[model samples]
Structure formats: C-alpha cells, structure tokens
Target: MAEKGRPRAFDRAAALRRAMVTFWELGYEGTKLTDLTAAMGINSASLYNTFGSKERLYREAVALYDRTAGSATNRALRGAPTARAAVEAMLRGNVDTFADPETPSGCMIVLSATNCSHQNRKVAEHLAEWRRTSVAELEKRLERAVEEGELEPGTDVAAIAAFYATILHGLSIEARDGVPLERLRSTVDHAVALWDSLVRQPAGRG
Candidate 1:
C-alpha cells in the first residue's frame, strides 16, 4: 500500500467507468468480483483497496452513470420549450442512449438490482429510490409546464409522469432485448402521442 501522491498502477476513474458499463450490462448481483476486476483491468487487491468493497464500487458506478449516460433526460426536462416537447425529448434521448452499440443496451438504474432477494433488499431499495426520484423530477417539471401554460391547468401530472416513466423503463427492457434503434425511436413517438389527450383530461379523474 502506498501513501497519498503515490501513483497507482491503473487509472481509477477509467476503471470505474468500465465497472459502470459492466453493471449496466449485467445486474449488480450478477456481476462477480472477477468480472469487475477483469473489466477494470485491475486485480482484486487494487479493487478492494481503491473502492472499499464491491457494493461501494457499484454505488459509485451508478453515480457516474447518473452524471454521464443518464444526464440527457434531465436536460430535456429542463431545456425543452413545452411539456410535450420535454417528454418527447426525454424519451427519445434515452432511447438513443439505450440503443447505442458502444455502450450497454439498457439503463443502469432500472435494469440493475431489480428483483433482489431478501439478503439483497438494500440493493433493490437503493435503485427504487433512484427511480422514485426520477418520477418526482418529472412531476416537478410537468408542474412547471402548467405554470408556463404549456400543460392545461389542473392536469394530473403525477399520473402522467408515472406513465412516461413506465414507458421509459419498458424501453430499457426493449433495448436490452436487442430492439433496433429506429424501432425504439418509433416507440417513443407512439408514447408521446398520448400527451395531448393526457394533458386535456380533467385533473384527479383517475
């Protein structure tokens, strides 16, 4: 073990990026220590020394994903001119990322840690919180769109957000199953088509 300023054998950030892709392609529990060490191009000792543990490394990898591959949806929600446009941009942007051959086929947060067993409950809960936060963010953006006169007053934004979130999650599964980019983009178009009627529906109408 070396002290601070002692150069490491491998690039830490680069290794983490590789870990993120591995977790994205294979769920958290499915990725073994050997898998990470191999992907990161580091040995077991380096992994444990640098990242503390596999769980800690996974958390960091997810954070990196949030800042990198997953940033586009947030940007769309903030940057688009209208609620419809924002939702469309968000979905389409994510679809493109999912379909990118250079990276894993699905979302890190959604596909990772799903269906964790009792012993892995905490891992499942962690991803659930991330998903709930994403839905909340969508609700907030839709509420803002209401204030901006983009969506009709009293629109049920919670339900709308949930609906779009489901579509977003489903698209990840589709991409993971090898759906073509063009077809996934078409799914986005089909999902956004409901925006008009959804906005017009009376609030709290179930």
Candidate 2:
C-alpha cells in the first residue's frame, strides 16, 4: 500500500463523557487545552484530530449534558399527570441533581459557559438560547394545561413559564454556591406553592 492512516486508539464515547464532566466542572474558558487532554486521557494531537477544536469539543460537551443531565427535567415534564405536578417534579428533579454525589452540582447548561468574555461571547449566548428554549418548553406545557381545563382560561402561560424558568436557572447558581440540598428543596417547595395563585383567574375573569 502507498499509505495508510493509523487506527484510532481511544474509546471516543468514554473520552467524550470525561471531557463533558471536565467542562461541566471547569466551564468553557476556564478549561485549558491541557485540562481536556488530561481528563479525556488523550494527547493534544488526538484531541485536535478528533474534536477539531476546543470550542467544538466544548459544544459537544454541552450537547451531551443536555441529553444526559437534562433527562431528569424532560422526564418529569413528560410524566407528571398535571401541569402543577409537572412543575413540581421538574423543580424537585433539580434538587435531586444538585445533591447527587456522582456529578458536579448545579446545571451544566446554566453554569458551564454563561460568563464567557467578549472574545468568547458566543459561548455565553449559546447557553442563553438553551435557557430560552427551556422556558418555551414550560410555556408549551402550561398551554396544554389551559386547553385541557386543568388551568383557568385566563392563565398567563408565558408569565408562568418564564417565572418557573427563572427559578430553574437560579437553582443552578444556588447549588454552585454550595447551598445545602435541604435548603434547595425548600426553595423549590416555595416556588411550587405559588402555582395556584399564578394561574388563578383575575378579578371578574374566568
């Protein structure tokens, strides 16, 4: 043969998972190239050849987090019987995630790349889009609730969704700040308790 490329040596899936955890813990700009290589158990050349660039690898890590860590919220939203129940389940899932000993505390999408600098502002915007999408999901669920008569016709779906999304994003910061799981659960309970008033009919409206 005139030439043959060498076979790849590492487990790519396993390596990507490790890289995801590294980025989850250290964030985008805070993570050095050496950090990725070390955590991934791969060399610099392999990192470049496989992942293309640090930013690309970071993007993949965030996507992986959305697929994995975010499963809890997705499951809760999909499985609960009522919109109110779904909201509680989603918030409670955050408490469980924050307390989980195996993974980094707080949400990866909310925490990992949010404060990127002007030179890397796109990374921050990427995460902001994810937060926006989450609010949309909540709004969609609430709309279904209103259509099904579980909520009043006058319910402010957008406001309710945006409010819960704010609490969801805030939980990430609180957990990252080292708040205890018990305290986090209490915060979620307080938010959950507000749903009745939030969706209630105003004054003379139905």
User: On a 0 to 1 TM-score scale, where does candidate 2 land against the true structure?
Assistant: 0.92
For residues 98-150, what per-residue lDDT tens digits would candidate 1 score against the true structure?
Answer: 98989988899999899788988988898899999999999999999889888
lDDT of each: 0.90, 0.86
Q: List the residue pairs that clash in candidate 1.
A: none
Give the winner by TM-score: 1
Q: What is the overall TM-score of model 1 with all chains considered together?
A: 0.93
In the range 1-206, model 2's lDDT, one tens digit per residue, is 43477645899989999999999889898899999999999999999999998888888888888788766677777899999999999999877886677898889888898888898998899888888888888889988998999988778888888788899889888998899999999999899988888888443443
**TM-scores for every candidate against the unseen true structure:** 0.93, 0.92
